[model samples]
Target: MSGDNPVDRPNGDDDNERPEQSKGGDENNPFAAMFGGASTEQFAQMLQGFAQAMSSPSSGPVNWDLAKQTARQTVSAAGDSSVLDRDKRELADAIRLADHWLDDVSSLPAGCSKVEAWSKAEWVEATLPTWSRLCDPVVARMAEGMAAAIPEEMRQSAGPLLGMVRQMGGVMFGSQVGQAVGGLAGEVLGASDIGLPLASPGTAALLPANVRAFGGGLGLSEDDVRLYLALREAAHQRLFVHAPWLPARLLGAVEEYAKGIDVDTSRLESLVGQLDLTNPEALQNALSEGLFDGDEIANTPAQQAALRRLETLLALVEGWVDTVVTAATDGRMPSALSLAEAVRRRRATGGPAERTLATLVGLELRPRRMREAADLWKRLTDARGVEGRDALWAHPDLLPDADDLENPEPFITGASELAEFSDLSQLGWDTSDPPVEGTPDDNAPEANGPDSPGNDDAGPADGESPDGPDGPDGGEPGTDRP
Candidate 1:
């Protein structure tokens, strides 16, 4: 009976056919070419590796560990050297001196509690937390869109595989973000170089290597360049520290923009429909090229408003820093003007990393109105003096608005009035109250009457009051009376 039953016959012909069946399975696999004809065992191992990566606790909308690893690799690939001890000491000394110089020029107190030199990799690591804050909103939105785009029936059928797709998306986003940050690491001269407080508060860090590269072609001495850069960094720190509301406002604007981000579902659907899950590399390449970015999706009204607010705020901040640095270095550093121009050019024509970031985030960090903002600040300083100018930063509402950037004279002229009004309000003046009957109003015309000092009818003469001096024509004192 055992010989007759194929299921029970382990030593029968069926046992001899198992190897052929395994070979057939490998040959029929859709992923064979992607794996370069890997054997079944190798394929299984590959899947296991992918599963491990996907299941990694660090995996979310981004794999921060992988991002850091990629950034370090990028820094190495770019041949960025370590920060030497000499460079560190020199930078620290420059920054300390720069802070002292800033004290005489700015009303704000010293903002940097520590000054240090950093290697490119260090910059990436130090600034990545900020990068996460900036990037997560955009990534999360995309991930949510992707998950929602899947047909309900398909998602229900896919079950756990859908979760795997999200994991893959995280890996892809991390790779792209790492590349962007790595590129930035090589270019940024300091933690605050991008007009953002990307580093810890009161910590001013300079990348000596980038600073040296920045001065290489400027025909200026290294010391002067370092000092000038240090002044700018210190000035930025002062503003950030003094204006406590700034960091949150800037980051909040970015987050707000990202929250309003709406994907072009049609375009996203097309891209997703074309994705080949077996070849994850293609998805990465597409993301690197900005598959998520399209004019249709980028031009939403809400995004435009957010971008405008963010850009305006950035421009104002940069402009204020520029004005302060210029004032600080003006007669002290002979290379001040040259360095200022160089910075303007550098910002106007951003580096590769900036463009990459723009592509990744759909927000251009460059301050388009920086020059205007600088001019506004300079004029404000001239009109209002240092104390009044610095007072504008006491509150966000007190700061100049976007409209003020277009023609700053109004804001500058009105600053005193605004300040006075603010002071009055602070002093318990009720602005909403009607004017008292007995109080003299400068805006009101003088009433003409016999008792009024300037009344012609009460004067001793047509052109003179009783107490007036002789007329220009030297008429007798009372003869001019009409």
Candidate 2:
């Protein structure tokens, strides 16, 4: 019985007992521990956990489920209140009146098909899809850059652990987006507050809670503040609808800029060093607090060029909105000037949420030269009337560039010539060769409103760069990433 007892083995240990003990101890090796124990069931569970973490509500560059969850939690923490019935009625009435007033100042027709009053939480939910579209490419590129920054030997040695690094990056990005967006919900007065069409087309949405909070400091009546903001929203919708290409133009510019993002390898290397392979929860918590952020972006030439185009377009859009909104509210609203000045100041300094988003995404939607752009638009309206001023949207060729914003006189002086050229191009006639001085061709298609020219090789404007908006090798303005 004593010989049969494995525990009784002395200095002359049996080979069978020694091998059994060695095999059992192997289960706790570092490699096996990294895979969540040596048992096949344990390894399977670890993979299942990773899969669930990644493929929850949606899967791609970001963990959208985690993002939405975090955003709602943030909003709730900040005391979000649901939109009341009274709030909806007031916002709807204000928007309708705003549209009616805009009919006089704006050349485009009323574009508010629906007016919605949203709570801060609702705002987060409503804008999530647009946020996903704008942010995915940047985050994906960033993750790839982060992985590449790791030494090839380290990556190969890390092996299956690389998947955890990618998953960690997604979680970090998702948390960042959630916090920024949640903060933005409190700051934005309406869907287009930042001068982007964040909501559905023709859907003018206002957060009454935010509107009241904004007006509290202005000493203006809530009605006055609400109506003024409504005018701005209505004007934005009209411009977006009138120039169907504007939304794509603005969004595409952002995506193009994102393509040039260069991640900071040193910063990524530091992050990699801090990663606790055995303690994923600890690593995630540390990273989610912002070890990876836009501060790590290296400004490449392509990004700078793309930034210029984006700035010019954003300035033009906001300026047009400001000009038309001011015109609409000049005489009617007693606080129009005060309200407008308040808005300008807000944009100039940027709100807390705007700053957060800029830090997170490395992009600022606020136009730096919006005041100058506004002056140019006002000059165009004065020199060419509202119809002629707005006709610039007929084609991209006629729109003002950054230089035009600096010196409005040249653009205003040559406005007629530019208009003629744009009109000619719209007819598919070669602008280089002037048409015969004769009666109009009745069979030719009528010059429609702001529809893009069908011809691909339309000639460039005089003094305009032959390389197009950015540079010679630069892709088309607003070209999507291949």
Candidate 3:
């Protein structure tokens, strides 16, 4: 027998036997040349590696660790510079003083228990958990749509392969989230730059590097820019802390919107079938262009309402912060007005990262009526003091509705009147009752006619003295009345 024969080979070596040599035309076979004529063992190893990757524990809708790692890598690759110690100290001092200044302007007390300066990477790490909360609902919906895209019969036949598909979906969603967050990290100036409480409670963080970049071309002092940004951040922290229900309310709107997400199964199925797993860039492009494109999904009426609510709430928060920060920095920073206008313009015209986030979540963070909302807040402050203005946050019902933004006069007037009424009630006044009809009006002519009680001069005209002893000084008699 030949040495290569199965009879002479080892027990396990039989499965590894090579095919008979091909003719000269084999050299011209492109497929063989491309893979270097991969042997059966090599292909098996590749499949094994894939299987191992697929078998990773399916956490939730996203592989969070992978997402974090990818975000850090992305930030690193984007050249996120470290914050110098001096800059860090300056940031801390600025934030602290900003909080102090805010205390004078806003009723909400200082909320930041700790302040720190961060690099872009640190920002990603600190804010990732909040992003997860914000993103989970949408990502879960996408994962469900992906799984449901397959027919029941096909899914049953897929067996273990179905798990692999789910794992792949997690990876894909995680990658997209990482990309969005990394892009945002490079642009955000602080934890609350996006008008959401992205950082942990009692902690205020600033990105010195990003702050420096933002102030570079404005011809403004770096200190003024940092201080202005710090005031905004500090104001956000105060509002979020004082209004305990706000965070949940904002997040609930996002989730409510997410609940209405319905993916087009046909398009998703087609995309999945055509996805090129070997090329990550191709997969990302396909996802963005095909699966997540406008044509692939549509929001329901409820989702639209939820989005409106979210937008209004965001606008209110940002507007209040803007008003409060402006007040706090009014005289202290000479460049405050210019900085405020710059910030407004920046927010009104969002950057690429914000747009990308909107595309991904189907919810725009940019408050369309931010200016109007800010005006409303300022009107409220002018009509009602800071206490009355901040009291609106005491209850959701007290906050201004979308209609209130169109003409804030009614809302401001009503709020001020209500506050005044509340004060009267607290002082034991019966505001419900009508005023005494004959009560002397302070601005009316003096009551000098005969009908008045003080018309004693006419009544006693015939008397020797108009003022009798008892009438003038309440003496018992005219004798010794002094």
Candidate 4:
């Protein structure tokens, strides 16, 4: 049997449910007079107030039924949401190999994440909690904006419906998100390709068929593709599991930016009024098309810094994964180069899951900072060695910011001991000439002091620099990291 509380409309749902669908003088329909009479903004205002009231210590977002219904529909549309038993065993085997291979190259702990091969639908089910947490803050702010505009009269008469709409909106968006993500289930190579640990930390999961399908576009064989993807996935899991604060930091930055989003009610009113109940995609198109438009929602002063931090962090993750995976498969995989290129292109263009996330919450997960971050990590590893580079993850303060990603040399070299190695050749990476011995390393080239949270600390610390892991002598708040 179908879920009892299914959403009344799966498409864009803005229609009122009354027998007389005419745009006449029907007192029952608040929207009936919307054609030429009084403004419907008043009704919008009431709904907004209702949303706020319900949200005050609010327990839930949307009605759960809408989410489930939409998810089921999306799964049905994909026609391959179920994970095959054989694929799961294959994924586990691949991840096991990945774990062993990674142990030989990096100082990261062994076997932190459990490996699971998930069906597309299963992936959708498992990842929703994280998605909700990431997106709720922005949705709350939007709801707040809507609530603040409600009229006193509307609150006294039909305020209940206001709350209903907010709930409806939540489910509507969730359904849209589920459908979008479902479309992507057959596309993603692994859980972390989107840059965040979209899977449970210490657990490696892949969709075998999906992985094969992704490889189909390129001319690469399935075995080589799976091995390459497994390396990346395992590398990602290593970082997230070992770095305790990263997941929270990444999620927090997103929420902070979302909180500052300023929505224009006039536009929302027009959007809500014209919303078609049977066309969810059309509603999405309207928002992106500037129908229910507001001013641009980019970084604020606070947002600018936060966004930069997030971008840098995200970039570092990709960089680290890229370096580690490339090294792990060195001479081992024939299609490594081709696979790397394909992954980069995939990220740049973005998959359906990422696009769906953008629509659900205003955040885009394509990793615009990836190249810079990768360069920064490669530079640091070259200066300090892998252990030294990985040590930065022990504490947030030690991590590099966008600026540090720009210079890289100073941050990594500041704590690196050249005397410890046989020279630059032992470091193994070849980016540029080594910095002058005894020369001061400056991450912020022209600046005299460190940046915020010492976020730009990417240059490997010269063995002599005081910036190395502070042994109880550090001045920074998060300096005790590692």
Tens digits of lDDT, candidate 2, 1-482: 00111112234212112222121113212111211122343223333344455665235666667667767866897889888999999988999899889879866677666688999999888777777766676777777777877888998898877876677556555655665577577778888887767776666898998999999999999999999999988888776655655675566566676777776667668777777757756554334433233443535666655566666677788899999998888778879999998887776455542343344334444434677789998988899888677777645556787667766687788727545533434533222311122434222222211122222254544444765443465543322211
Model 1 misplacement above 4 A: 1-52, 280-290, 352-357, 365-368, 415-482
Q: TM-score per candidate, in order? A: 0.74, 0.74, 0.73, 0.70
Q: How do the residues 1-482 of candidate 1 rate in per-residue lDDT, one tens digit apiece?
A: 00111112134322222222111123322211111233344334334445545656453477666567767876898888888899988988998899888878766677776687999999987788777776776677877877767778888898998877777666555654665577678788998887777876667888999999999999999999999999988888776666655775566566666777776666566766677777645543333333343455456555555565566677788888899899988789999999988886665454432343344335544434577789998998898777667766655556676667766776777626445633423532222322234554332223211112322243343333454332333221112332
lDDT (Cα atoms) of all candidates against the true structure? 0.63, 0.63, 0.62, 0.55
Query: In candidate 4, what are the lDDT values of residues 82-179, reduced to their tens digit?
Result: 66787777777787788788877676665343677777677766665565565456566766766654555765776777766666656444444344
| Model 4 residue 309 CA deviation in Å | 1.9
Candidate 2, residue 118: CA error in Å? Answer: 0.7
32: Cα error in model 4, Å = 29
Looking at candidate 2, the ten consecutive residues that score lowest on lDDT are 1-10
Q: Report how far residue 374 has shifted in candidate 1, in Å.
A: 0.4
RMSD of 3: 27.5
How should the candidates be ordered by lDDT, best one leading?
Answer: 2, 1, 3, 4
Cα lDDT tens digits, model 3, 1-482, are 01111111133322223222221113222112111232344233333334444455446776666567667866897898888899878988998899889979976667666687999999988887777766777778877877877778878888988777678666555554665577678788888887666766556788998888888988999999999998888888776665655765566566666777877678778877766767655554455434343532434555555666666677788889888988887878889988987776665455432343354344444434676788998988888888778777754556786677766786777624345534433432222311133443221112211112322233432222454212432221111211
**Span of 10 residues, lowest total lDDT, candidate 4:** 443-452
